[model samples]
Target chain A: MNQIAETLASEHIHRDEVGAKIGMWLFLFTELILFGGMFLAYAVYRFSYRDYFALASKELDVFIGLINTLILLTSSLTMAMSITALRRGNKKLSLIFLSSTIIFALLFLVNKYFEWSAKFNHGLFPGSNDLLSLPRGEIIYFGLYYVMTGLHAVHVIIGMIILLFMLFYIKSNKVNQDYYIMLENSGLYWHLVDIIWIFLFPLFYLIH
Target chain B: MEHKNNHIVGYGTYIFVWLTLVTLTALTVTVASFDLGGFSIVVALIIASVKALLVMLIFMHLKFDDKIFRIFVAVAFLTLMIFIVLTFSDYSFIR
Candidate 1:
């Protein structure tokens, strides 16, 4: 009878772990909705002023955008490799790949900063700018551009911080081969960031 | 913790994604050089959707996840689409 009772208690723990995973997935769903709203707005505006949006997109630096895309794709690859390493119990390899992923993310942000500053210098900012001297609809186009990409950048920063936390968790042995829920979740979030950029690249930089 | 990385489909999907992205990028640039009129936005968005699907299915591992989670994501997207369509209708009907 006592053995039966102990078994039930351990079963409860496993159930709780699965429940926690579901909760995390639900939170991630909410984030998807949030980003989804922005994307919807972008689609509507782009549809309304197709010509103006395309012209505005041409003003963007495609080379910089392409470089950022490559950087993000590389980071995603590293992130996936990190997760694989964790599952394989290769703690050292996991940490190394995780660190590289973080570094690539920072490189992406730096490139974004330069691209944004150049846009500002060229008077292509939202609201009041020389770029707005075109049709009134183009003004709204740039507005969506800044808002969507800016929000994505904010996410990248948040993702970087999460990666930092995961890094520490690994160092303290809280995350290991037997248990790497944090690492897996962080990788999912990182991939979400990359996914957003995948859309943003075409919408903002290649608006054909 | 001894799982094997035997998901060949996932890796193959990533390769396909890279190729598609490159092709679509080039296609968009080429299309932009011409005068596609209003159809350009539609074409661009369709290409973007293809890219999004590849990333979501492969990189995010959504293809092999629980069915309930997949339903949740689908519902969220449907809700967002409904909201956008309603708002756009209002905007179009006003004035």
Candidate 2:
């Protein structure tokens, strides 16, 4: 009887969809607060060395930052559209949108690469001689800049991998209208990355 | 108890929000070029908040999802704000 019961438990069993969402949101809360601590550190340091921060922030390339902002925002739109497409039973369109989202993610990373390389060429790294000789505030500014943006870029990479898996899932018909939480959760994570960049952009690159 | 919600957002709405976000990005860049004294950071942060709200509400589908989802998001932001305010007290007093 026990063996029969084990066999009866199929993968199509009733799953608590709502509970899954709640759990995702709860995990997101922890992620949000984790970044909150970094923002707090940024605030304290910026407050302490207002002049140094102004000078250091001006060295950042707003143009590249602007481009990446648009890329991420557009990716968010594409990711959202992918969800809608999948739900509408158009796997082709869903995969296309997911591909676009991943491409945008790559574009953002490429821009970041050039941005960081330029800073490296100029010796703006945290403990480099140029930065070391600068005011403590400027050093702290670059330090925070590297740490925050580095961590955010890591999130972008993770998000892209998740979307890639999502694309495979959609192609396999494993994600349908009746069971698309995987897609939805990935969308949530992507948007969170975009939102964090939305705040990070103006704070680091825009404020003159 | 498998539950699925398919909130079909109009293509037009996503395009509209996209346009608005791009416009706001332009506005923030333009505003930063001007010297707003102490109000500069405040303005930038406000615009950032608005953009974040749009992504959360529409893109993330929190607007159409369960109200509890929204409530939890609200609580998270509120908790962050409380921490901010508490830190403000420390900074204000010490500095």
TM-score of each: 0.83, 0.94
How many Å off is the CA of A111 in candidate 1? 0.7
lDDT per residue, candidate 2, B1-95, as tens digits?
32456568977888899999999999999999999987999999999999999999899888888788888999999999999889977896884
- Candidate 1 lDDT over residue span A1-208, tens digit each: 5467547746775534445556777787787888888887777676677778877777888889888988887788778778777777689998998999999999999999999999888878875548667696688778888888899999999999999999999989878765676787788889888878877886788765
Off by over 4 Å in 1: A1-15, A127-134, B1-35, B89-95
TM-score of 2: 0.94
Instruction: Report the lDDT of model 2 for residue A185.
Output: 88
C-alpha lDDT of residue A107 in model 1? 100
Kindly list the per-residue Cα lDDT of model 2 for residues A146-175, writing each as its tens digit: 999999999999999999999888888778
Question: Over the stretch B1-95, how does candidate 1's per-residue lDDT look in tens digits?
Answer: 22322332333455566566667656766675676766766786777677667666666666766566678778877887788888888877765
Residue A157 error for model 2, in Å?
Answer: 0.5
Error of 2 at A184 (Å): 0.3
Best by DockQ: 2
lDDT of candidate 2 at residue B36, scale 0 to 100? 96
